[model samples]
Target: MLVRPHRSRAVTAAVAAGAAALVGFSSPTATAAPVPGTTVATTTTAVAAPVTAQADILDRVRAVPGVTKVTEATAPEGYRFFLIDFTQYRDQRHPKEGTFTQRLSLLHKSDDRPMVMYTSGYGLSTRASRSEPTQIVDGNQLSMEYRFFNTSIPTTPDWDEELTIWQAATDQHRIIEAFKSIYTENWLTTGGSKGGMTATYHRRFYPKDVSGTIPYVAPNDVVDGQDVYDEFLANVGNDASCRDALTAVQRRALGTDRQWFLDRLAQLTKEEKLTWTITGGMEQAFEAAVVDYYFAFWQYSLQSDCADVPDAATATNEQLWEHLDAVAGMSFYADQTLSNYVPYYYQAAYQMGSPEPYEDRIADLLKYPGFNTAESFVPSALRPVVDDTKAMPDVDRWVRLRSTEMLYVYGSNDPWSAEPFTCGREASAERRECYRFYVDGGNHGAKIAQLPAPERTFATQKVLEWAGLTDADPVAKKVKKNGRWSTNNQLDRPEIRGRALGRR
Candidate 1:
């Protein structure tokens, strides 16, 4: 899953403030030679080196083919970091036809340590320096920004010709091949949400590239009709009162007090300066936010929060608006936010099927009925010409039949868990090493460390064993409390939630 920042002014202000604090933690900058046909941005710094000659690593990386720019930066205390841009093919099979340069971040700890390749499903800004898989395993980290995201956009985006899953996997493969020449150690690949799905697709296309993969909260094929998510919503969480309260909140937002909420939404749009290209205008965005409230509640929050929901009849407008803004923020469907996700929408509509919203349940509440399709999330210019002939049944078949040595983690309460890959359970005894874990009561933030007892041990052991780092146990070191695993220390662990539904 992609991890996108909430683009509200509040979030932007917070980011700007935090950037200043990060400046002091960074290492001396080192500028790299520029690559041809690209706008280059470099930061030069100085730092210490050991007998291993860390100083020369930059020069060696620059010598690699297709490497356009390499800049040294500060990394987590134990590692050194560099940002690199490489020239890649728009189509690997027909490379001569065209090319695009993509960006990647390399966090080096030691040459002989294990390596974790994190594949992001969307364009990644330079602000993000680490990934969840990188934190779980003791290894060097390489984070590849997916094609058409942030800095990875093709010179001339031909969505029809350039945005294929195979092409994305190939982009990861070339980076792996190039970096292996230097790292030359055990390699593991992982991602969450769409990124997790991307990692699986990479494994499907090139099983030999990485020894193992851990796709967190990764769903399999998207069941186009809302049937999958509908079943999930009906059964999510452990309390009926909380579920009913959530439904009540949605009804109030869209039904009896809708105009009041719409007036508040309009006032917030002006105060927060929110803007969207949603075809139905502010009213549609308001409706979408109501639909999103149900989704966001389970996706990122604890079920216990639902108990705090007020009854529609007795609740004040401030109470309802406060809960809505906190969970399903208005910024989610803004024009700028939607624009940032055009590439993802195209891919979902074309080859990667997306889950349809449960409109039947909210049919009467919708301002613009039938506005729940994938086409509704994107701008009019990029609406995909959905073709039924090109679904991903073959990919599904391969995952179930041949994918091995993989670990899939999910949350019982997470809606996406409704359509998890069933292959691990269906595979023969010989492929039992391919494990699927569902964290009891966990949400999208569920990780192997959150699991209880033997399950946590088993999940952690499998990943370490696969990465050839059996001696290092992040779960045991961090999660064990009084001889049992605990997830209370979530703030310290790697974040598992990917980009909200939009990127995934």
Candidate 2:
């Protein structure tokens, strides 16, 4: 959901000025003044220039202690980008234990402009040049790569003691404090899926760090058995025919045509030059793919063009294979994909809850009925100790008691949406700032911009108003009618999409 800036300076300036006006800040006007010593000499001062904002913010960011590196990055037009690495403590409370250098990307629009902090729950592949939330808020963007993901891993890792959600939230707090020294404006935090979950966790731990939070498709808690996911699968799509068609496809792939699909999968594996670290080998991986197919079908392909799964009885091998590969391919469950998700699994197993796969529907067709656990999806080498519930209890309490000025967007059809944060009846009556919008018949790809008419307009206005931006009602009206809000096309690819089973 990263955006590349290609805006003209005139547009950037106008937007910045408008944002300032909305937030009750008046931009200083540049005017020439006569010098005191010289009768004819004069000097002009430009207030809030983009160049000054960039230089001042960069200098201040570099000066933050533990910042090991700051390299200039090529960014979209009208913006300055930098890749930064900061030495952070593995245990922030006990700073003497050890340290790890975490990576973050800073996309500076202006020092006086509002800031959008995108919390990436996993390793960031690239600096999200632009994102839906950033566009709606129209501010400076900071994309943080979660610790232990990508190049942010610790020197001597202690997963049991260090990879807690509180530690991750602490990392975000430190970054926000450092950057607040320069930006000095209202800050908004956001992320999608796990990233969205990270945003919620940060707000729970450090509520005052940011002005508002907008978490997209973020689940609040992970149930040990993931019964909610089972409930979600029981009812996902809008049409019964579509759901039945999907069920038929699942049955065909895992039942009558099981061997054929497996052979085709093997051939596809060879053709694609795939490899995996899965313990159950190709057959096991195939089973996982079968299980994944059900989730992926509803999560991504529930759209019109993809939902009409062909009748399995009349479908050719090629047709089935094409649909299967496109929907839930072996590459998704391959070793490479599994390897990158060890940190997520650790978090899920230890503190963050995981959802269990719904096997009752297709149990008769499953090759390994016992493969219901999420642990099967993780690489065996990086097994997690599932005894600790870390910060789940605290986060739960915070959401129930203190969460405010928060906007949560979720899709009605998304499995993750099943466990959205629910405000208690008393809180719902008392809390006006907190809102959750469930897009009707929407899937995982849903965003505030993509929501239909009045809802879309309502969400836009709410978020902008929450971010302290002025003219939100007017802008929301225009954007809603014209479809101007940024859309989130990049979807999360978690190794285990649903709840993890077999909790010890």
Candidate 3:
């Protein structure tokens, strides 16, 4: 069912003016009401702690895990480069103890080679702290660091106005501006998920920073983006086929106890279960498992409070995995944020307030206005404000930012498929000369790994080539439609290829 879209006059003006305020591009803040949930920085906290000297910044950055070295340069403008430890950021975000500050590492390489200034996706940590890696020519990795904005902003009119001011000041625009000051010349940039969204916005709002871009599974349509959020909710709303698929799994689990399921899985041979081949082998399986964990881990991770399986290990292993796939289409439990009805429930619920206004706006402005309609996928809680286009706009700005040189990748089975919905004609038409590849039976970003030896070499070589850097293979052929880009094996059928692309 579809709900009406809404726009907050105050929010619209605030965002527009806020965007304008970016590097003093547009007019100053308008007469619209001040944005809710923001606070101006008070003079009181000015002396919290002195920052490290500029000369020492690189040294501190190099110490982080995965960071091989840090380099500072004014080349390509004022930007610095750090060949980072991507593996490090992914692990550290889990956290064991102590307060952690988000950071990025800058790397250096031969100026003659094309460079990439990589940024990361959405998370509680700021860009400065996360160890985002930059893969340079000749297989060198550099990490980039940036700052964070953690001030709590009040969205409610009756809530604290000061906090909201704080958020508006340290808004995402400031984050981008701060990063821009570090680099001068054009470079290609990319990120996945939230990073993807940021990259999408960056390509449009700050085209000067990047020459071309890549956003893996970017949820550009954040307004209706999470329509597939909760499995329970999705089940209630799904059509018969979808409902039955999930119901089958539920019934299977009903009579079985958790321990019973675990024993069943333990008894299965590698060949019978096909778990080993699921991800090529056990070594690769570890990495794939982590990636798979992400879909639900976001909801339960330390950063947010959503839900926990409690006895996750105790759960019926095989049954649990099967159950996960069965109901996967229904759950939007991204790290416990919205999925769990919990202590932090108020925060998620509060975020819902921003979209409440959209529902009313959509009803008044569009043909399929009601929330109960078949076309409407708006969550019940979000139904009240479906029209708040101010919080989630149509992103026409994306058109101005599309690139022909871009390549998109996706796993066909990705849960986010229903929201961002990247594989559409509209997306294809929008970007000129863009190629989308579906990895047969591959998960998100899994195609490159699954490619046969030559294909893998070709794909890896293309990334280097795109960066204007050369490698040993220097693949000259385009990624062909037949999958047999090289003189190797015959490719699979289109449907098989597409289905294999995102089966994670």
Q: Which one is best on TM-score?
A: 1
Better of 1 and 3 by TM-score: 1
C-alpha lDDT of all candidate models, in order: 0.67, 0.64, 0.31
For every candidate in turn, the CA RMSD to the true structure comes to: 6.1, 12.1, 16.7
Model 2's TM-score against the true structure: 0.80
* Model 2 weakest lDDT span, ten residues long: 1-10
The order of the candidates by lDDT, greatest first, is 1, 2, 3
**Model 2 lDDT at residue 361:** 71
Q: Write down the TM-score of every candidate.
A: 0.84, 0.80, 0.42
Candidate 1 on 49-159: residue-level lDDT in tens? 222335467765665556777887766566678888787776777766666667787878787777999865765445435555555555778888788665465444566
- Per residue, candidate 2 scores C-alpha lDDT tens digits across 1-504 of 110001111212222222221121111221122211111211212222223334665555665545555777777666788887666776777776656667788888777667899965765534436656777866788888787664466545666677778889999998888777677878999987778888988988899898888888777663455447777778777677777777777788888778897787677678766665554587777776667677767665445844467787788867977776666654455553444455666677667776666676788877687573556755555564665654666676777767877788888877777778764445545453677888777766568866877777777766676666675444455665675654333422232222111111
Query: In lDDT terms, how accurate is model 1?
Result: 0.67
Tens digit per residue, CA lDDT, model 3, 1-504: 011111111122212222222212111322122121212122321222333324244443443232222334342322334432221111112222111123344443333334454443312211122111133222112222211111111112111211121222123333334333333333566654434444554555454544455555443344533444344223222244433333333333323443353344334323233233212233332222222232322211121122332233355546456544332311111111111111111211222111121222122222222222211222232223223333224333443235444544444344332244243345446434344444433333333444556645555444544555433333323332233233211211111111111111
Task: Choose 1 or 3, whichever is better by lDDT.
Answer: 1
Task: Please give the lDDT score at residue 240 for candidate 2.
Answer: 74
